[model samples]
Target: MSSPEQWTRPEPGAGPAATAAQPSPEQVIAGLRATAEGGAELTQLLTPEGERQPSRFDPYLADIDDAALRGLYRDMVLVRRADRECNAMQRQGQLGIWVPLLGQEAAQVGSGRALKPQDMAFPSYREHGVAYTRGVDFRELLGIFRCTDHSAWDFREHGFHPYTIVIGNQVLNATGYAMGQKFEGKVGNTDPDGKPSGTDEATIVYFGDGATSQGDVHEGFVWAAVYDAPVVFFCQNNQWAISEPTERQSRLPLYQRARGYGFPGIRVDGNDVLACLAVTRWALDECRHGNGPVLIEAFTYRMDAHTTTDDPTRYRLSDEIEVWKHKDPIERVRVHLARTGGADQEFFDQVQADADAFAAELRDYCFNMPDPPPERIFSEVYAEPSAALDAQREEYLAYLSGFADGGEQ
Candidate 1:
């Protein structure tokens, strides 16, 4: 046995007493809410007021001219319109459910545009803007929401994997795929002139801050770190994971977690399209050079409910939503374009018209989409024919046939 003073552990820090130094619950909540402005670590090239900010990452955006910037703005507008249309359709019972990417257009489109043709992307469902950049037809996505198809686009053709509904599982898939790329010598290849040989490839996996707590995500991080896989872990930290706040998930910022896994971590203002493009370009370049894996925490906010089924008002304050509205991703780009004369009123009108047409096309496609045959589910279960599955399919069809004219027996 030791004396009380000898056995006592020292206070953790040099501040006041431990309890006195700690922040109250209200303070913590306030801090979490104030994070909408991001921190000093955040890499931003565009301000909420639509002013351009100089950054060390500017070199990565040397290729983005006025035309390209206008294109990015157009992409965000169309994506946002499509998202709103889908959400409305879901409410009207056209889609089974809709996952709206209302405030995340910049994060998805900027990073999506940064990808080369050979790169692969694994998305965690709400990456509609990315799908657009990957050459996936907007009409094809309607099939998934309408429940007429699992995924209509070919992954090999688009370099975009089918959406993963299971939280954080796509990270493991992307990691394994990246490891395969390394084993095949697809990364870090160079020509005799010390230039890229054009065979370099990388994989990017998208996840949410909430998924960081999942065991699968942790395991994926560890495996990627140990193997040095050319995978970029893109965490869209949209503040809330459903009803749970980011503060509840991790004490440290999400990007800081990469240091523990032995990789570089970057935090970018996800609402700034220019910054997202620049940071993603740098991260992809690192992966192509085999200096991966990197973690990017995109500081964004989700301005809509998690899905058509969620009611955000029950969990979050309207004041917080109003605060984020001032930082709307699409408006910033539009303002920048107008202020700088990068785009005129004609350009804005045309983009809005195009977005309206796009939404109309999506609505038409969803309304006219045909339902899949009941046996369609059994068809894709296996590569080779299975007798047991065939028998089960026949049994299911026969059972369905027992009803008269598709009505109850």
Candidate 2:
């Protein structure tokens, strides 16, 4: 395994002058190498045509009948509609801003569904869909973007952490949490009956392509490898990080980076829901067995703007978006369902209706979401209010009351 000490050393033949402080560029290059020495498996359970491949993690997905597959399809559709609708809401001035997961529904849903009740998740801001799957209120996510609240749900309550706005900060946090779980003896031990103990829980953290450039992410890799953290560092390599393409992030494939960290790293077709689910489940299982942390780079295309505020048309071509549209995640699942006779016309119709109804309800909720009480703003800022804050709050309230004509009375 490549340690931090190894990464900091100067290469041979770089001369004595090339000390740790001032190593030659060639020495630095030789010292820091790519991690893809050993490749990984990228399985696709349900092909675009909706066929099944044997899954080693069959226990995780064994009960997924035709109706269940249709439910998964419904999940993708509703989430996408919710995503696109939120973007449109932002455009129409309902939300302050929006992050569109337009083309990555399968990536989010597949992995999100793989999570058990005990498993924890750490997410970037774009993981609203995954949050939705975890029983987080859809409107709660809007509170952050709408500038109504800092975070919507309590982390402990949801078994999910607050959305980290900093690119890769959650990567390390997830690793640390998993490590803590291990230290607490919550992982790797068998049950009294000699059966596998379900008490041990794994963690999954989501990140984007740009996060690969952050030092925190690399440090996360280091810590996870050393301690064998039960964490899955899921990198949704959506091809572009803002205006910068994947080419600028690293020379080799992103999934291969896991080798240097002494763990398995697999690359899946992010646009393929089955592929994403199969790969993520396998990685999580390895973690549950105390054999991880794993890295997953879901290779996908970002078919929408980086955010509602961004204009992808400024930097990317129309043809590129069109190309990915043909590889639409929802379409492939529908194809698979149709091909395998898993879903008939009635099923498709019900799914469409469900998606539309959910979208409409979400739109209503977003518009009707009450603005939080003024005091709620500072409620969680401090567990116990300091003297200064108390005095300030009183003064502010008094000042506001003067303008309000004592409306409370």
Candidate 3:
């Protein structure tokens, strides 16, 4: 990126003469190739074709045994299935709205598995995949979209906050939590010498490329850096912030922005599950040892619309989606598991069967879910019901009863 003073635009009246001679076809193709190469500079442990690639970060992948690798595959498969079901339900009118994590399964599952139980997670609304890896039932996710609960599960019990619909706000929450951990000596207690220690808990917060432009996220970065908070800012740069492409948000790669905050930033191939796992594990380890507040930009693409209500075709090209298909995260893992003898045909079949059964059960649950009583909403808002709230609920119920059954008010 260049400062405005260092770069200049042509005079507005120059018209066609201002065109800096359109690039030759060969030059255009070369520039595209270069762009891809720059992106490929990130740490990638696995290729889209299911081949294992070596990197300096290889040590982080040590404990990821064949069984663990298979488990990761299972996580992505099931998460993807659940997401697809949610999208379908929304389209079928069983859900009011749905945020599908269509193509980012590997990124979510890989990083979600890296956290220890004591650590915390503050998620953006679409982290259903992370919730899955955290052991939250897929069925639980539907309730929120079904408009019955604020969220599907309890935030405190799971060490995961309720989904923050306000973009980038969760970053501050995660940062504050990490700061609290430091204030209470939760961090660096086990590693007095500052060496790596797994005993110290960390916080991992998820956001998207768009959030990078938000003040809350930047504020979180500043707070985390200054306080040395044991927080990892995981940004899934899925190439778009709704209809706005990433270029509009940042002049440079999102990861590089961490430099301004005085911490290390890393870019990992988000579509590569093994790579995401390794990078996230390293980030959490750094925080545990009190060298925290890392920013990891997971470079990937969202293969679906921003939400069920979004018409992606209006904003993006079909060719772009097709290109990302070759880089499907789940497909690579499945291919690796089979080709490398990590998993057999029987195992693959079992995984598919389980995923299908789970999706079917979820569909049944969504279809049969009864409308929540109107009074139920006010009950959960406060721990001890107040007279005003109770009276308000009663008044609302009375108004609702004014309408005849199946008749307009």
What TM value does model 1 have?
0.93
Clashes of 2: 2
The pairs that clash in candidate 1 are none
Please tell me which model should have the higher lDDT, number 1 or number 3: 1
lDDT of 2: 0.78
The candidate 2 region of ten consecutive residues with least summed lDDT is: 30-39
**lDDT tens readout by residue for model 1, 45-153:** 9999999999999999998999999999999999999999999999999999999999999999999999999999999989999999999998898888888787789
Worst lDDT 10-window in candidate 3: 1-10
- Cα deviation in Å at residue 404, candidate 1? 0.7
Model 1 spans with C-alpha error above 4 angstroms? 1-25, 406-409
Model 2, C-alpha of 127: deviation from truth (Å): 0.6
Tens-place lDDT per residue, model 3, 58-122, is 89888988999999999888888888888888988899999989999989999999888888899
TM-score of every prediction relative to native: 0.93, 0.86, 0.89
Q: Model 2 over residues 12-46: C-alpha lDDT tens digits?
A: 64353223344444433332222211124555566
